[model samples]
Target chain A: MKIGILGSGNMGSSLGLLWAEQGHEVFFGGRTTEKGRAVAALAEQGTQGGTNDEAARFGDVLLYTIRGINPAEVLTSVEVLSGKIIIDCNNFEIPEGFAYAPIELSLAEKLASQVPNARVVKAFNTMAQEVFELAPSPLKDYQVSVFVCADDAQARQTVMKLAEDIGFTAVDCGELRHSRLVEGLGNFIRFMIIGQLQNPYTTLSIDVLPAASEQRLGGRQP
Target chain B: MKIGILGSGNMGSSLGLLWAEQGHEVFFGGRTTEKGRAVAALAEQGTQGGTNDEAARFGDVLLYTIRGINPAEVLTSVEVLSGKIIIDCNNFEIPEGFAYAPIELSLAEKLASQVPNARVVKAFNTMAQEVFELAPSPLKDYQVSVFVCADDAQARQTVMKLAEDIGFTAVDCGELRHSRLVEGLGNFIRFMIIGQLQNPYTTLSIDVLPAASEQRLGGRQP
Candidate 1:
């Protein structure tokens, strides 16, 4: 599957490496062809790079990793993003790291409205750069959860496979409205972790207790 | 010390019963003298019930369990909460069953402002009513956790011990501003539990890993 990464920042590059390592065709969407090429060259062999618009057209799915607020411009800057599975890994946190409640419309909502016909799913917004670096699943030889929320069932299935393929346990957290809870949890941690307190190592473990029976999710870690 | 609980609801009654059980002079504050006496009669032996003003004056510490939006009116109706340790358990969420965010002043800040000289500490704002009723402590008894946030150290310590005496594990979550995260977590769970994805019986147990080599706060479970 061709996976396109929007925004060639640290997160976009990390995802590109992960996907390319898994043998999927990974594309980096950058403002310029040269920037996109730089990110692609950083990926494993067979990975390709292109301009933001070219990446959108080239991939089967497009992932949004830009700042939570930056997608508004990036979506419009690119000519079209309709009918593509857009995974939102962005959050609308104000500058200076103050998590003052959430915004009027979540980033996913705005993206869905702005990019008409785009199948948007909220995932991977709650994890840190290191957690992505350490993606867990049966694919990765462990099980860490990746929560997926979307209105489209097929779109959710597509996202789930990609998540599992990339090596993380995928749990569908119901429809898109649940993104409010996702963003709220993220915001709470953003302040709690970034704001700095005791046990500031990795903020929190995204893994849930595996119901005592499921060995993969949880079993005698303590 | 005489302890007062305004708004004789389940929460108020729960705390009052437990605290009175622990030998604190607990008073259930109701609207009128007769109403207070009726509830008091239903309470454990030696537990007192009185009018709102009388209860507020009867106790050295007052715990306000009134509605979130009208904290000022609620406390003012109590008549004499000034210069007392009034524990706040309020968060400003809309009554229409939606996630409400406070833009102007947070509920903790508002409660502090409402009771000018009263030393207001935020506690019992993180757990569900059921969790509070069970009363878990770090010592291995049914230990329910209640995060505490306050500006005054002595006042916070005082509340922390009171929380322990009533079978709760009070984690000092920094100052009052940090109460925002606990409030958001509590609100998030309030909806999440009803949503059924999360196991309501799942409790977050804060323990020191053996590597950390920390002893239990409540000592040990039975």
Candidate 2:
């Protein structure tokens, strides 16, 4: 699969390298191609670096990791985004590193609205860049959940597959509207691990224990 | 410990029974005392029933589980709530059962503002009432996290202890202002488990894996 990373920051670089290692063609895009090229130079596989607009046109699947800027403004540089699977990994935070004040629509939802033609999937915004750097092997025993939410079912499935391929458990949160909750979970995680616990290595996962009836049934359906 | 339950709903009743079994004196309070009385009657311990105002004045620790109505209006019935540790176990949801539109202050935060003199601690709002009914023994192996947050450190610790006593792994989420994030987590869990997976038996938890350096050090500090 061709994956375009629309930022040259830690998250984009780490994910780009990881995908490159997985034999996916990765294009690292940046405001200036220098940083993207430097990141791409580290990869031995089918990886390259270019301008954001070039990267946007290069891949069917795009990892939108740019922060601070309005996504609509950024996407305007690209000619078309229709039918493209845009995996949004952006979380809005204030200067204090906490989440921005609650808004009516989440960042992902806003991005979707901005680029109505694009199949927007919200994923990978919950964890830090360091998490992507230490993916799959180091945390194989523990299930690190990557929540994926999208209005398009197929896009959601595609992004979930990408997450699973990277050795993380992907939770399907359903619908673009549900991005608000996912973004909230992202902020909650940041507040707990970074703000409260002072632990950067931590991540959140779900533990679904069997019901009493399920236990009594001994694997049999009720 | 004298624990006052300010509602006769499933959450209030379940927690009231749990605390009662843990040897705490519990006062189950409701709009009308009949439901509270019936729930309290199920416990063969130092437990009783009363009206909301009576319960508010009865215990050193109070469980604020009343929903729908504004907290200020409910607390008005009581003469005073100064210095009392209030465990806020309420999550605001619309009639459709999804979380209410995102607001500036969380329900717990709003409650804290309403009762300025009370020591407000947010906890037990993330899980379903049935989870409390299951208790510690059934979920002994799983580390089900109960996120506790309060502006007052002592109140936070008190709530954490109560959560631990009930056999949950209590996570200290620092200040009460972070309640917004916790509430967001509650909504995320609901959307994923009930709305998406259609599984009422599931819950979310944190899985903090060791860092690469920690793994390499083999119990030695760097």
Candidate 3:
């Protein structure tokens, strides 16, 4: 997959490097070419870096990692995003220690509306960028769940496969509207890790244990 | 500890039975005495059942599990909830398949304002009631996380201890305002289990795995 990262921040740099290491063609894009070039220089050989527009035009799949700004301002700079698989990892700013979603739509949903033709999938927004920097396969003993939500099923699966490629459990969280829930879960995780646990490296996973009936009928026919 | 259950629904009955079995004086309160009586009849000996007001008056800790209706309507029926630990397990109605919190406050936070003297703690709203029925110690291999949030430190600890007594891993999520995140997580879990997995028995947990540095420093000092 030719992957484009729309930000030179922690999230974009970390994910771009990981994907590049996994043999995916990665392009790191930033507000300035020099910033993207700096991150790209740290990644694997043959990886490219350029302006946001150049990176948007470079890849079939774009990882929207730009934070603390309205996505439309950055997205409008690009010429064409039609039919591209956009994995939205952006979150609303928590200026006052509380994450507030837009009244009716989540960040991802709003992004989808901006690029109407692009397939917007919400993922990689739930965990810290440090998790990506940890290793190719970070939680060796357990699986860190990456909740993926998109109206486009194929794009959702593609992004899920990419997440699995990096060794994270990808949970299919249904349509784009459900991004509101995923975004909320992201806030919940942020508070849990930074506020309560006081640890940035910590991650969350959904552990589905065997049902009582399943346990009861362990040796018997259903 | 005396415990009062404000609703005789699935959540109310399951938690009430669990607490009653734990040797706490349990009271099942419902819209009608008969409704509460029916559930209490299924519990251990000495467990009582009556109207909402009687149950509110009976227990030092009250579990508010009423759904669909405004909590203000039900809570107003009770005479006094001063200084009592009120574990709010109610969630907003997801009528159109999305859980919507109030514009300015979460359901739990709103509950706190309605009865200012009551120490409102949010817990048990994130999982299905069947988890309690699975056994006193369900998910034996894995610790199912019960996220607890409250403004009162003592009340928070009390709820956390109660959750632990039922074999759950209680996570102190800090103040009651953070209940917005927990409630959102509840909605996320609901959609994942029912809408995505098509299983009511599934549960979620926050598994904070070893950080990269911890893994790197295996058997050595940090």
Candidate 4:
């Protein structure tokens, strides 16, 4: 698969390197040409680095990893990303302390509205950059569950497969509107680790488990 | 400890029964005396039934289980609940679809502001009534984790102890403001099960796991 990473930041570079190492053709792109080239050099598999516009047109799938308030401005410059699967890993700014932004409109939803033609899927925003560094599988006993939400089933499946490619258990979390919940979970985890648990980002990854099968029957037994 | 359940609903009744069975003095209360008495009958230990006002005055700690739009109205009617630990388990109504209510001010925060003297702790709103029905432990391999949050340390600890008494592993998730995150997790779980997974309420319970210890060190080891 051809993978285009739109930012040369920690999250973008980490995931881009993982995908490239997984034998996917990856293009690392950002405002800083030198940093983009430096990140692309870390990949053992086929990889390249260029401007955001060049990378946007170069891939079957694009990862919007630019951590900014508005993604529309950056993405609008790309001439041809129509019908491509765009994975959104951008989260709104965390205010001082641990309180998250009051999510009136989700970033994924906003991006979807901006690019009417593309399929936008929300994933990978819940965990920190250190989490992505442990690709394919974490050192934990439980699998790191990634919640993927998108309107298009095919697009969601593509993103889920991409998540699986790097060793994440992707759970379908329904439509684009459910992005609010996913984003909220991300913020909550951050708050729990930093503000409450007082633990560093490296020590923890969000893992969800299922209930026992026998307990599935509704109502109390006589 | 004297446990006052201010609503004879499923949540109140189930928890009140468990606490009563655990040898705590439990009082079940609601609008209807007959219903409160019937709920109180489920408990084996020392328990009683009465109106909400009577229950409010009867205990050192109170569980507000009445599902209502405004909790301030219900709590204001009872005088002298000052310095008492109040556990809030009420969740705001989510409309027909998966969209959650935009909670600008959390119910726990509102209740805290309303009754300036009482200590408010938000908990148990994440799972369904049937979950409380399977008390002491779930059928799964791991113990179910319950998250407890509040402004008052002593009050939070009291609620955490109460949660543990019912066979739950209570995790302290910081101050009262973190209630929004806990509540959001509740809503998100609901959306995933009902809206996305299309699974019925009987089939699920929220389960969270811990990460490995070695993974806590920041950055990759080159």
* Share of native interface contacts recovered by each model: 0.04, 0.61, 0.50, 0.26
TM-score of 2: 0.90
> Candidate 1, what DockQ?
0.10
Stretches of candidate 2 above 4 Å error? A70-77, A95-99, A216-222, B44-46, B70-77, B95-99, B216-222
On a 0 to 100 scale, what is the lDDT of residue A1 in model 2?
93
lDDT of 2 at B135: 73
Give the C-alpha miss distance for residue B209 in model 2, angstroms: 1.9
Q: What does the lDDT read for residue B156 in candidate 1?
A: 86
True contacts kept of 2: 0.61
Q: Which of 3 and 4 is ahead in TM-score? A: 3
How well is each residue in B58-174 modelled by candidate 1, as lDDT tens digits? Answer: 888887888664445544553466568888887555334454553344577677876677888888765445544344232225344567878777778889999888666666666
lDDT of 2 by residue, B124-211 (tens): 9777766664576565456788998899999999889988877788998888888888877777777666777777667888767676
| Chain B TM-score in each of the candidates | 0.81, 0.89, 0.89, 0.85
Which is the winner by TM-score between candidate 1 and candidate 4?
A: 4
Which of 2 and 4 is ahead in DockQ?
2
Worst 10 residues of 1 chain A by lDDT: A200-209
Clash pairs, candidate 4, are A202-B216, A203-B216
Please write out the lDDT profile of model 2 over residues A26-106, one tens digit for every residue.
Answer: 998888778778888988786899778768888889999886465556654544688899999987674374644885788
After aligning candidate 1 to the native by TM-score, how far in Å is the CA of A152 from where it should be? 3.1
Using DockQ as the measure, the top candidate is 2
Of candidates 3 and 1, the better by DockQ: 3
lDDT of each residue in B9-109, candidate 3, tens digit only: 88888888877877889999999999888888987568999888778889999998865454568765534788999999876666466545433567898
Candidate 3 residue-wise lDDT, A122-214, digit = tens: 999878876765555545346788999999999999999998887788899889988888887887788767777877766777867677766
Alpha-carbon local distance difference test for all models: 0.65, 0.79, 0.79, 0.74
